[model samples]
Target: MRIGLYPGTFDPVTLGHLDIIHRATVLVDRLVIGVAINRDKGPLFSLEERVTMIETECARISEETACEIVVHPFENLLIDCARDVGAGMIIRGLRAVADFEYEFQMVGMNRRLDASIETVFLMAEAQHQAIASKLVKEIARLGGNVAKFVTPEVRKALQARFGADC
Candidate 1:
């Protein structure tokens, strides 16, 4: 079976992430959403909370597609995680030119680590191109409405985390 890995901080899986996940499932037999436990990033949500939020949001996708969607937390190198999960491909979401430059470099390094693992880039929908998890959390923390950026579950979680109605 063709398995793919999509790794990200996913602090609170944004609509952009959902869009990518939906489209990515069509390309691989199984798509594993690897939630990175990067303490350096200072994520708004804990790894467990991020995994829960992604699981709750991706339930429908997992049911509808032949592709299985798995949300797993990993802390080591992304290439190592992909290899560990038997992923033959890595799925990445590209928002703009800025994102490409960074992803491009990472892809090269990942290729060096495992030449067999391919990387696929999916462009975010125009509407979601501007919505990033960090910005969404910032807006919500400052008491702004972020219902459009993230799923309802994530929004509720954000509200509770920030102690403000978003």
Candidate 2:
């Protein structure tokens, strides 16, 4: 079976992230959404909250995708996590040229770490190419509407975190 790993710091799941997850399902027998517990980045949501948000959002599209979706939390080296989950490929979303450069370097390192694991880069749909978690949080923090960028549950969480005025 072609199991693929898509790892990221999903502080609060966004529509863009879901878009990638949905598209990734078609390329693998099983898609694992690995939410990274990176304390260094100081995420807006807790690890459990991030995991829960992904699980909730993924569940909404579970039936529509061709592959099984698994939401998991991991820390440290992503290559190790990929190995642990028996992922033969690592899926990445490239939004623009900036993303390509960073992802390209990481892909090379990942390849060096595990020669057996391959990396697959998927370009984000044009509509979602500009939507990022940091920008979403900033908009919410500044009392801007982010309902269009994130799911209802995530929008509510952001509202609750940044107050009702957001």
Candidate 3:
């Protein structure tokens, strides 16, 4: 079976992420959503919360696409995480040229680590291209509507975190 790893902090899975996840199903029989435990980033959601969010959001995608989706939390290197999940490809979502610059360096470093595992970049849909978890959180924290960037459930979660009015 072709397995792919899509790694991210996923502090709060955004619509852009869902877009990539949904599209990635077509390329792999199993898509592993690697929720990175990056303490340095100080994510808004805990590891368990992030995993639950991803699992909940991806359940429908998996059912619709007939592709198995798994959420795995890891604090190790992304390349190591890919190997652990038996992923032959690492899927990444690109939003803009700025994202490409960083991803390009990552791909080079990852290739040096394991040339066998390839990286695939999927550009975000135009509508979702501007949606980012960080910006979404900021907007929520500042009492702005985030319904456009996240699902109803995630929006609810953010509201709970920032208060009902926010």
Candidate 4:
């Protein structure tokens, strides 16, 4: 089966992420959402929480698309994680030119590590292009409405985390 891996530190899975996940189902029989355990980023949510959020959000996508979706948490290299999940492609969501610059370098490095695995970039929808988890968290922390960026469930999680009625 064609398996694809999409790796990210989904501190709180945003609508932007769901957009990518929904689109990615068309490209692979199985889509593995790799929740990275990057301690350096000091994510707002724990790995377990991130995985749970992804699983919950993706369940509908999986059912609608008939593509098996799995949430796999990884603390190792992304390329290695791809191999672990038997992914022949690594899916990435691009928001802007700034994101491309960083992703370009990552693609080069990942190619050097394993030329067999290819990386595919999916541009975010215009509406979701501006939504980022970091910015979403900041907006929530400051008591701004984040209903536009995240699902109602995730919005509640952020509200609980920040103890604000955002």
Candidate 3 colliding pairs: none
In model 2, where do residues sit more than 4 Å from their true spots? none
Question: What TM-score against the true fold does each predicted structure earn?
Answer: 0.98, 0.97, 0.99, 0.99
77-166 per-residue lDDT for model 2 (tens digits): 999999999999999998899998898899889888899999998888999999999999999999999988898899999999988655
- Model 2 score (lDDT): 0.90
Q: Which window of ten consecutive residues has the lowest lDDT sum in model 1?
A: 58-67
Predict model 1's lDDT versus the native: 0.93
The TM-score ranking, best first, is: 4, 3, 1, 2
- lDDT for each residue of candidate 4 in 37-133, tens digit (9 for 90 to 100): 9999999998888888899999999999999999999999999999999999999999999999999999999999999999999999999999999
Tens-place lDDT per residue, model 1, 8-108, is 99988999999999999999988999999999999888888889889988888888876799888899999999999999999999998999999999999
Which regions of candidate 1 fall more than 4 Å away from where they truly are? none
Backbone clash total for model 3 is 0
The TM-score of predicted model 1 comes to 0.98
Off by over 4 Å in 3: none
Candidate with the larger lDDT of 1 and 2: 1
Better of 2 and 3 by lDDT: 3
